[model samples]
Target: MIRIVIVDDEVFVRAGFSALLSLADDIEVVGQAGDGAEALSVVRQTVPDVVLMDVNMAPRNGLEATLQIVKLPEAPRVLIMTSASPDNTAWQAFATGAHGFMHKAATPAQIIGAIRMVAVGGTATTPEVMKRLIDENNLRNPRHVAQARSRIDLLSGRHRDIILLVGRGYPNARIARELSMSENTVKSYVSRALEKLGVDNRTQAALLVRDSGLLDETLANESRVL
Candidate 1:
């Protein structure tokens, strides 16, 4: 069974998710909490396979809680459930090593699927959330930006082009068509680019590209030469 803990500031949300997830035979709602502080206690007691956390809570928010939760030895995979705008929160979720983020409005099926996938060490993030993560990386610290850019600089020019499209959340087919390359060729480039950037997935690669400010930097360089 996939054990889970639901943490939200709202009682109804916690109860509702618990009830819904209970309907799935493979999933068990092991615990629930009304805030991030309480969540830590519950998780400690339950040691669940997945944690469905809310981004907002009193006394301690989900992001702060996440920073701690992920540090635990044998930590449960965290899937942030957010009612706020995703652009600002999704990046924080991934940067903090949370497995995923889903809007609170997501259907029960989506929620269940996300939990299951995360439990198996798979990532779950919608395309919109991916775009948001990349865009919001621009607002991060200059040191992080420089680090991301330095890693990105390790790629060849073609690899860099592919990753920039990835930063925009373009799928392989779309990227292939846009760049006039075959899908297989794009896939090869993506694989190499991911290795060079040292990220496990496309989302991380995209975040690195955005944080690098590569697009802006390249444009400035071109302008200077003109």
Candidate 2:
């Protein structure tokens, strides 16, 4: 079973998550806390496998809690749960070593999925959060355009095409349809592109391409061809 601890300032929020998580056969609610200090105490005692952390709490906020939790000898994987926007807070959580970010508005299944994914050493970022990262990177880094072009030049033509689609947020099914390939083939291409780019997943691959400045080059090339 996956052991979990819920940390949110509001009593209802903590109780609600605890109750929902308890209903999942594979998840056990080992502890719940209404503030960062309480969370730290509970975590040190229970050492749950995953922590559903809230970003805004009295005394110590979620970001501070996450930093503290990751420092523990047997630190549990953290999945930050908050209503805050990805633009303002998500990257901070990521930088603090959170394995995933989930909005409080997410469904119970999504919450559970995020916990499971983090528990097993995988990262999960909500699509909205991913989009915010992309948008912010674009706005802040004009140098990325040139960098993306260089990275794209390092890849085969097919791989470059796949990376371009991923940067634009096309799902595998859409990418397959656009390229006239099977979904499995598209998945294979994505996997290969990730390996070639030295990235662990699509989001990182997309970020790399964006930060490298390839998005502009790819678009310009396509425009010229048209």
- Runs in model 1 with CA error above 4 Å? 134-146, 149-226
30-71, model 2: which lDDT tens digit per residue? 898888888999999999998999999999888899888887
Clash pairs, model 2 backbone: 144-212, 144-213, 145-213, 147-212, 148-212, 148-213, 148-214
Query: Could you estimate the TM-score for every candidate?
Result: 0.65, 0.65
Return the lDDT, model 1, position 46.
95
Q: Which ten residues in a row have the lowest lDDT in candidate 2?
A: 199-208
lDDT of 1 at 150: 86
Model 2 CA lDDT for position 52 = 91
**TM-score between model 1 and native:** 0.65
